[model samples]
Every structure is written in C-alpha cells, then in structure tokens.
Target: MPPSTISRVINATNGRDGELVTSQQCIDHIRTQRVNNIGHECISIIRHFQSMTANDKFGLPFAPFTGVNHHRQSTLLGCALLADEQEDTFVWLFKEWLKCMHGIEPDAIITDQDRAMCNAIHSVFPTTRHRYCYWHMQKHIIDHLPTLVSRYGEQFQRYWGLWCNSSSIEQCEGYWVEMKEKFDINEEGDGWLQTVYKCREHWVPCYLKDSFFAGMRSSQRSESINAFFDGYVNSQTQLHEFVTQYKKVVTHRRLSEAHEDFKSLNTKSVMLLGHPIEIQAGEMYTRNMFDVFHTEFKGFGTEFCEELRKDIVEYKVCKFTDRGKWEVVTYE
Candidate 1:
C-alpha cells in the first residue's frame, strides 16, 4: 500500500532516523523505526505498487489497506507512506505495517504482479499466502501478447478460461498442456506465457481455492479503495490542504461503514434456495457472503448418487458434466 496524505510535513515524520539511508544495509537499519499514527482496521492495502507511476497530485508514501468487516463491507486497515518503490522501501513499509497491526499477519495478501512488492512480501511475511491480481494478469497478457489476443481472441479465452477454472491441480496441469498445444507454443521458450506460467501457483485459481480469501481472490477491491479519495483530492491538491481533506476522507469512509452496518442488521435477504444449508449459511454469514454462497449452491445439482464401494459404502454425488462440480460423501 502506498502511504498517502496531504502534506509532505505529515508524511515526513514516519519514525526515527527519518529512515535516512544510502546503502542497502542502512536502508534495512531504519526499518526498525515505529510508524506514527497511521490508523487501522484489520488487513489489506491500498494502491500496492501497480506500475510504480509517480504523481504530483496523488499516490505517494500513503499505503492504504482495505479489508471486509463483519457487515461484509470494505474497510480501511491502516497504511504507510513510502519514499520510493524499491524492494527495501517496500520491506520497510511492510515491516511498519506489521508493527501497526501489533505483529499479527494476514492469512492471505493479494496484490498486482509487481516483482519488487512480491519479493518484499516473501521476505517479510513468508507464511502469508500472496495472490496475484487476475485483473492485472489479464492486462499484462494483453500488453505482452497483443498479437495472440487479437488473432486468437476467442480460442485463447476458451483455453485460458478452462485453465483458470480447473477444479484440481492435476486438471489444471492437463489444461495447461492443451492450451500450449492449441496455440502451438513452446514450453521451454522464455516468452511471456512461459515466464508467467512458471509462477502458476501464485496466479492460478485452482491453486488458491483452499485458502480463505473471504471471496476476494483478486486485487480489484483495492482499486476501488484507491479511488476512495478521488473526489477529496486531485492532481492539483496541495500537500497542506491534503491533511485536512484526508481527515474528511477517513470520516466519510467510517460513516459509510457504519451506514452499511445499520442496513445489514435491519434487512433480510430473500432466501433463494430455502434449503437447510442455505438457511444455515444465511444465519452464519453476512448478506454479501450469504449471497455468494447462495449463487454457488444454486449451481450444485446432484444428477445421481452411486455407491462407489460396498465395503466402505462411499457415495459420490456429481453432475453429468462433472465440470460443473463433484462432491463425494463417505458412509461407513
């Protein structure tokens, strides 16, 4: 998250030593400094090093992280302002964020495929699951392989979608082969496809389904949070005025969150399924999560249930296509 704000004076006092450094070791040394009053919610970041573009109006050191609250609304989870997009700078930023969070780490962190940010995440929070933004990945594919997209648009999406929607790791691997052959691309070559494919575990959905991302599998949510201040501050926003405006931004966002909480508590979503599982899920989850569960469950229809083995009496419930879904239950 790019720590953002109104005035240079505000962002200048992040911690001790002012983190002044020239060498890598010295850069690492200042990372120990405690960040000042950045504020918090839970976990997630705003504008995480996407393309590393600088600006005179916005997007400097202020790194805002967004998270989902109990009301299932996006909430701010603290932030930091950095001097640059260097790997060390990000490491220091992440370290400061960790301190701000009381040394607690998120279960999963999603961001754009910035190599520097990715490396910093691995160095600072190795145990956390880092997912690449599929939105960014798609943009990158079009940017890197314009010819492939323009020429083989439909066919490419067919294989690409299949690969992305694979139900298991083995199936994902098989689809990868088919995709490569469909395009007649070489696996050993150092092209865009080959390079991105090497890091499949990071971007692939089938590889990430087991992780509890709370339905946020991409960094797209962060994109909206990044724009949370668009109306408040613009390209010409002065450093000093930004401080006052930022307070309004925070207050407005908090008020919006409270409004969402009020609505969530007062309303009831229409029960689409009325099934016991759906009913139970509605009782347990917030409106947004229950809606997600309802949509997924609606796609689940058991075409048949057959006994796989009489000894264990394992019954497998699956759809005719199997591509839709497959569920197995064992009765002993």
Candidate 2:
C-alpha cells in the first residue's frame, strides 16, 4: 500500500513492462494482477459484506424490497432488505443492486409511487420503463381524501380506471377534470394528482396500445409474499431469522411459480394468462374503490341486449363509504 507503488499499480498500462522488484508494487500488482480494479472492489463489496438495515419503523413495517413478476398472474419475483418509507434507503438499495447486477437487462418494473423509488429508478434503470400501480394511487387518494365518500360517492373509483386504463390522454384528462370538480379535491389532492400524473406517458399510452403491464403494476402481489412469513415478521422476529425465513419464502415462491408453469404447459391458457390469477373475494378486491359498468340501459328498458349484441354501455365505476367497516381495512 505504498503511495508510489499504489499509483503504479493503479496506473499500469498494457504496454508497460512486467515484473517489479518493489514489495509494495508487488503487493498492489498481485492484488489486481488478473482483475479490473473497480470490478474487483465491486465484487468484494457484494460477496464478503452485509447491507446495513435500520430499525426505524417501530410498528408494523413493510419488508425492505418486494416485487411481483410482470405476468398478469401473480408471481413473486424477488425480495430484498428494504427501509421503511425512507426514499434514501430505497435509492441506496437500488443503486447497490445495480452495481451487483452489473449488466443484466430488465424488461419492466412496477412499484408504488414512492418518490425515492422513482428517483432511484431514474438513476439506475434509466432505460427500463417504470410504472406506478393504479391500485396504489387509488389507495393513497382514498386514504388522504376523507371527504371523497360524501362528495363524489362512487365516482372516485372511476378515476383510477380512467387514469390507468384510458386509451388516450384526452380520456384520462377528461376523467381527471371531472373527478377534480366532483370531489372538490383540495390542495393536498392537487399535489397527489400531480405525482400520480407523472406516469401518464407510460401506463396511459400503454393502455391505449392494449398493453397491460404484468405484475409490476400492483404491490398486492408483493404483500402476498410478505404474508408468507407473517408470523415471524409480526412478532418482532430477529433480523437473522427474518432474513433466513425470507430466503425460504423466496425458495417456496420460486417453486410455486415453477409448479404453476408445469401446470400451464398442458394448455395454452397459461400462456394467454401469463400468471396464475388469485381467486380472492371479488367484491373485496374489485368493488367499491372503482369499477366498470354499463349505464346505456338507464332508460332503454334494460332490453338493450336484444337490440345490441353485448351492446352494453361502458362507464367507470366507483364507490366511497364512511361506514364503520373502515376499521377493518387489511392494510392502511
């Protein structure tokens, strides 16, 4: 580690002569004899190292990293150590992962509307398209906008569908304006909308092309992975045990996906569907927040089906309720 030797070792050129007599130069020389300096350091960092985690969130907390595959069927891709709500941690973890991954290319990514995660995505995977889940945005809006239930009733739900599924920017904008007026969205709502609109160019346009993002669009699938180890995580499990169980969960998830793939090989249905669809309570999963309905028969005597083959009207659906049932929400 002598200064002169260190410089010589770091600045060695292919045209330079070999064998050095200096001990320091010999040490530096041997350290990087067959390795690229930066690459060596990066490899060493990942191998004999532990990424730090902070005990910040004292209550029920989300795992550090979670992901669902891009297939429509729910598939857990991978999970990693993550920080609770700290954008810096997400960014740090993401950056570190990029360094570890080196050159592997990713097709698409889905994540919540976390500003830090967005920033990290921009920095590390600039070419990789990042999508914010429509469901996440709607949940955030509902949680923040308390008066939405009384003001617009079911109309609020339509906003998510329109924003996430609309074919054209014009349509999304139309629904945006309608919801803005109907809900009397306050300053907070305006700010939230601005953040949500940031993804318009991606998801909005993709919907127009009939390109549905697979699992990355929703965090629900990620939660399912966490639920596998709920017992250990819920009772303040030790960090080492948590990490070990997490690895097992990942192994189980991968095996499950492989099994699903085997089951799917028998028919084309799996290819068409991409992933195994979870059969949860439809009303619990799809009702209330927003939906699609046909109101064309409002005055058509409900006989429109006779006049038109599936000539059903298409309208966005939503529901908002302030009843005591709010206390039972699975996740706040």
Candidate No. with top TM-score: 1
Model 2: which ten-residue window has the lowest total lDDT? Answer: 288-297
**lDDT, model 2:** 0.54
Candidate 1: regions farther than 4 A off: 1-62, 144-164, 174-188, 272-275, 297-310, 316-332
lDDT per residue as tens, model 2, 116-184? 777877877787767666687667767855554555577666675665566676777787777677678
lDDT of 1 by residue, 1-332 (tens): 22232223344665655554234444343454333323531222334323223325355655678787766667777655567788999998889888987898888999888889999999999899988888888788767665666665667876877887899999999998987777777866537777778889888888987788876777766677778778887755766777788888779879987887676677787787587887788777767777777778877644567778888677876565557655545545
Cand. 2 TM to true fold: 0.47
Q: What is the C-alpha RMSD of each candidate to the true structure, in Å?
A: 17.8, 20.0
For candidate 1, which ten residues in a row score worst on lDDT?
1-10
Native-vs-model 1 lDDT? 0.73
- The models' CA-based lDDT, in order, is 0.73, 0.54
